[model samples]
Target: ASTPSCGDGQCTLDEDAAACADDCPERAGCTGAEWYARFDPITQEIADTREAIAVAWYATGGSFDAARTGRAGDDPARTSDNVWTAPSEPGVVTLWIVLRDDRGGVSWRTLAIEVG
Candidate 1:
């Protein structure tokens, strides 16, 4: 067996923190009191969700836009609410959240989610 490596551009369900940092980067501001996403059961089953999307956000970053891969549907909406949605599939979905500051400096974050 081989160890997982970050920045390989390939994010799999088996990948871990040391395996692929690019796909599983950490977000200090998007958890617990500052959660960014919520799964909607009404959308689809937990294992096979490639249609609907789960909402995501950036707790206190003003506001932002989003985009995703590995599914089918309209791209997640970009609004002040920062209501981005994850792909419905149950494994290894990539989500990119873009944040623009008032001065126009742009930055983003990515997550490799194993849905289920």
Candidate 2:
């Protein structure tokens, strides 16, 4: 398959506002929300440290302000935030949020957003 490029007029799975703002215009609005990562509290307390967590955002339509967001190992924050702009048309859009930790742990969540 060919690499997805901006100005193609087709927003592929890999394209978003950050990657192709022109092709995928930001239309929908989303409040800034926080997403949490799972971790062992005991280990975190013992080491006084936490694994770095990163989140990758994807959607079937619309666009995201950022491709990823996360907290570093040294940072105490347990959540990451991202803003999603919905597609211009009204429909059900599939969205995915994937989270990965510095220790190779990974998880993901799928959301069905109803745009009107």
Candidate 3:
């Protein structure tokens, strides 16, 4: 059988903002925020530090937060921007970025990043 595709102006259970970026794009002109990090020379991947795993929300009047939803237990450092940093340990980590506006409206974006 074939899987259903997104479009038609409806966000079904099968299609999410993350999966269907173009259809559910935000006013910021981006479906989601940007994840920034410096490259790791040793592992050839992103390093685990405050400087890495920082994200920038392109919208105004909102704040962002990050949390590690996987096995590791390291608190991520977050500002209104740079919401979370990847853990120093190596493995697959699920990261959540939550953005909220002054009027109590909220939006969420998640990424399963490899902290190798």
Tell me the lDDT of candidate 3.
0.46
Error of 3 at 110 (Å): 0.5
lDDT of all predictions, in order shown?
Answer: 0.44, 0.76, 0.46
Off by over 4 Å in 2: 1-48
TM-score for predicted model 1 compared with the true structure: 0.30
List the candidate numbers ranked by lDDT, top first: 2, 3, 1
User: Mind giving the per-residue lDDT tens digits that candidate 2 earns over 1-116?
Assistant: 34659898966666778879988788653222334456557666333345678899999999999999987877766578899999999988999999887778787877777787
Residue-pair clashes per candidate: 7, 1, 0
* Tens digit per residue, CA lDDT, model 3, 1-116: 22437776754444567877666665453333233465779889985342222333422222235332211113343333445445667766654555543223455666555555
Clashing pairs in 2: 28-86
Assess every candidate by TM-score.
0.30, 0.58, 0.32
Residues 1-116, model 1: lDDT tens digits: 34565567666556765657787666455221111343567875443222323333442222235432221223333333444444555444565555543223445666655556
Query: Which 10 consecutive positions of candidate 2 have the poorest summed lDDT?
Result: 28-37
Candidate 2 accuracy as TM-score: 0.58
Q: Which stretches in model 3 have alpha-carbon errors above 4 Å? A: 1-80
